[model samples]
Target: MPTIVHTIRRGWVYSPFTCEYCGHEDQGAIHMKVGASAQVGILQDYDDTRDLAMGTAHGNMEQAGDELIALSPCPACGKRDELAVKSFYAKAKPWIGSGALFLVVGLAGAGYLASEGEPEMGLLATSPLLLIGLVVLIAGLGKRLRKLPPSAVFRSRNPEPWAHLGPERASQ
Candidate 1:
């Protein structure tokens, strides 16, 4: 039987004030810890069962250390395990993983055997260096083999700075 692992994250305002998102009227201050979470302010623990996750509203931490809450379900963003954000590569399609697995194994076997065999005086034929070379070769090939979509081009962090954090314009 397969089981799904649910990851829960939690974060809280250093001290409750205006909503983080709207930033309208300030909400009364409440001293409370958040709960478990993936990142510092990605998601929050919802209920006792620890199934659903709550998104952070908005709140910044203090400097020099004054108003620190937490995420232990116990400090509001004071301190807790960091949030978990999936890596770009990790979210790849299944085919990528399949190709990578095949490449790694193929190269490892060839590499190990080549290294264990014999070394020549003029040019080294097999050694630790060869194994490492094979691993690198396989990795590079696997990266290129992955099925990447045109839209995913924006995945690179280097995408235009403005494209990512551009100012918001009034909606029509």
Candidate 2:
């Protein structure tokens, strides 16, 4: 059996928020891009994670217990609360957009051929490729819409290196 491997570029997005009670500004929500691949892999190993941490840390920072401290106490308020996730989403642009484009182009070419009176040839030429593209597009969109990162994403109470927290937590 041959081992299969591929490269994927992924990331987490965080937005700033303010505490209404104490006029404190901090990261309000963390938006992570999640999908099927995320279910079985680790996100912390990616270089993007290092950059994300650099943006949030202030001083004397270090990785503790294989996890980065993405969230910290508000400078003024001194309260360590979980920030809300603005949205749970995944990047499907590559697959969905490309797949749709392929479908359109293939159909257009087929239509042109049919207009030229070779209807049979047109269908034969474009059907397979169009079908493949359509399947890829749907799969991509489904992964993006359904698989989502969670706000309570923590392992051993540590920030996940890739920030792909985990499954959603039960509401209390």
Best candidate according to lDDT: 2
Clashes (candidate 2): 4
List, residue by residue over 36-98, the lDDT tens digit for candidate 1. Answer: 332322243334223332332122222101122111211222222232111323444454555
Listed in order, each prediction's TM-score against the native is 0.21, 0.42
Residue 115 of model 1, lDDT score: 72
Candidate 2 local Cα displacement, residue 88, angstroms: 6.3
Q: Model 2: per-residue lDDT, tens digit, 1-172? A: 3222222323543334354446665433332332222111254543444444443331112121111123434445644444321112335667788889889988997999999999899989999879988998998788677733323223323344334444452110
The segments of candidate 2 whose C-alpha lies over 4 angstroms from its true place after superposition are 1-90, 153-172
Once fitted onto the true fold, the runs of candidate 1 whose alpha carbons sit more than 4 angstroms away are 1-126, 150-172
